[model samples]
Target: MSHANAALTPRHRLRIARLIVDEGWTVVAAAHMFNVSWPTANRWAQRYAAMGVAGMDDRSSRPHRSPNKTDQQLVRKIVHLRWKKRLGPVAIGGKLGLSASTVHAVLVRCRLNKLHHVDVRTGEVIRRYEHATPGAMIHVDVKKLGKIPDGGGSRYVGRQQGNLNIRATAGRPKNNKRGRVAGITFVHTVIDDHSRIAYAEVHANETADTAVGVLRRAVSWFAARGVTVERVLSDNGPAYVSHLWRDACNELGIKPKRTRPYRPQTNGKIERFHRTLADGWAFGKFYNTDSARNNALPGWLHEYNHHRPHTAIGNRPPMSRLTNVPGQYN
Candidate 1:
């Protein structure tokens, strides 16, 4: 029997063997019926007799030993930092005093990198800018928005509660729909150009008085953290164009710079800060009331300053990269 014409089915081979045993068929005749060599026929017959159908299954081809396996303790540490501590490989490496490559290898071994998931609605990431020295320039801006509601909306509101008041329930009230809320509820944020350290305050209005208050608070925040405000850059909004704002800067002995009308890129740092605030903190959250949103601000700011890793700062937190020299702000 030729190998090219062989019938590979286990049932067919078993039937051929049974024919030889029950009907006294010769080995040559059974081999010819199955189109297999006599040795192949005899081998199948012996396997069937010893282990029934289980003997026909193929054996595993994998090797018994892995020579270059990663260290289990190192892998455990990497996974712990990534999952429990929420640290990236670079920071984990810094803490563990390991090279980035070694940390990466451990992360790969523990499947840490594969577990990272991102929200689909997240906006495209903008490139980061880093200033070499603190107080080179600071970016400041205001973000005005509608008030959020209290006790976030449940998914079954329409079906269970039959509440079709989507606009009235989810957003601000109809009477408050004018530019009043838009012009008010401003978030004044100031970010250092070099350290990327940020200080933000939520104001009730975008007036020049509110801007001055924000600038004062921002200057003090940086001063406490040992970063001076040499020059502040802002957009050409009406509040920023007022003499009051310039007078405030003059009082603080700091230079006030304004971006050209309709050109926000000149104050790109604050624009980026706005995007970070919207995307990183506000985008996915549903706050029922303005107070709820405001309440969450401090926590998110803490995370941004102390925990979140910045690739621009060599994967260190903004606060971690800061120098605590007292005279820097003085």
Candidate 2:
């Protein structure tokens, strides 16, 4: 393929070459006529003189020799390890006594970087599918976040403060006979498979009613952005399998689908989003308290949906895929 930002097509280059080589125009005059640099025009003219018309065609820019490139034998060994052991870059690197980055580069070159790209059982490249349109299938899941203690969580604060906060809250909750676990905040998350647009809410629990309510709101959220929800995909969690969830889907006229048991990969999109949520929002920065952390979700969510570039969608924000989003203009 021609470079996306190429200044001239092969036809235009051929014209430049003809002007310089056939018409006997000066390289400077030809470059000025074609609005190209002198070297560009001269190079094409030289190519045409040497190889005739075929030389005007686009050629690969890759160097003929890459001295630093990994050896062919090493590349084959890396590929063999991927197929025979189904190991990730880190694991493969550990076994081969190579740097993880070197192994990772080989894996990327071989197109076996993502686990889903390779079948688990056969170690063969697998074809993965996605919904072709927005809202064709939205993934729903609950991410349980450890609520920051009143004085901040261990992530930001010291473990001593964490234990103190735990001990301080031990007698507060009625069900906690042993107060080892401080508390958990359920973050109901919904993500579109096509655009990777996401919606999330922090709640007290992950009950059937709460899940249904989140689903209802999430549908409305997408609708406001001009996307109609056709289906919902989720794991076999207690809330997802409940009658309330089924009834809610039925009432909303949306199809509900569940991943096969023990196969979290079936709902991989949301799972990956949850990891991003953890890194970008929940643990992105310091929080004086859980309430402070909760207060930051909307702002981060706004940035994620409207400004943050998603690699799956070619480095554009998810909002780029939607219509009539009021925030889109802003």
Candidate 3:
């Protein structure tokens, strides 16, 4: 028999009955030929004699109605809150007065729970830093950044310091008698080792004098927020090893700590800060002049310290982890 006529349908049973009656085939033979049981063949033959092919159709396996199902309105609300408001199921459930599991069930039923919504190129899982107390240690470092081009048609310009104009000279060998390294600008930064609270200052030079000045400003900056400085850690750079730096640390009663030579990981907290600065600010930036780049620093730093959430502090801003002030934490 053909596949369509061999199925458990009215037409199939009629074909089987005709094969058995006209061909003189036994019920066992008809069942074997149709790939069905002898009882099924006999029953179909009886049905074909009484009600014909119309009685051979099989009953559906599905239930006529489902009594238990997720609410459509709740599922719609879950999807809307997730995609529109960017709220997780827990937050959505809290707002809509539903349990998290119920919200999750609705999302799963709607097939909208694990949708890829974030940009894959920029989306990376960053590990959080864990530190409890404030002022246990402080990370200090200087980041050298590329100079921004000044718009006045000149390739090089001078940065003014008080009454002096620190002019940039032509590039020459480091050991050359007349050459000077003036193309780089430095951002001196200090971060609390425990809270990751940061303080930064832009400077034209990375000399010991500039380092000392930035450190002083950093101390004052933290002091304004009721944080005290105990230990300042840095790499073994010449600026950090100078007498001026030591004298300044002594005057301020701050312990000066140095990392091992060639191993920056010893002072990792501030080093990691530099990595964040480069990735979050310096990378992919387009600027016509160095002054413009420098001008943008304050805004970016402000955002990083006060607005940008740090995963290290349970998605709270760095300033929030600094103290127990309201509107700062949580």
Candidate achieving the largest TM-score: 2
lDDT of 3 by residue, 168-223 (tens): 32341245322222357789999887778888888878999999999898888777
Output the TM-score of candidate 3: 0.51
Residue 56 in candidate 3, Cα distance off native in Å: 45
lDDT of 2 by residue, 130-244 (tens): 9999989999999998767677666767787876776675334545435545678899999999989989999999999999999999999888777889999999999999999
Q: What's the residue-level lDDT of 143 in candidate 2?
A: 93
Work out how many backbone clashes candidate 3 has: 4
Per-residue accuracy of model 1 over 50-160 as CA lDDT, tens digit each: 776676544477679867665678677777677666677789889988888888877666555654342112221233456678877888888775554333333323222
Among all windows of 10 consecutive residues in model 2, the one with the lowest summed lDDT is 170-179
Error of 3 at 9 (Å): 35
Q: Which stretches of candidate 1 lie over 4 Å from their true place?
A: 1-130, 153-184, 324-330
lDDT (CA) for every model shown?
0.71, 0.86, 0.72
Per-residue lDDT value at 306 in model 1: 81
Question: lDDT order of candidates, best first?
Answer: 2, 3, 1
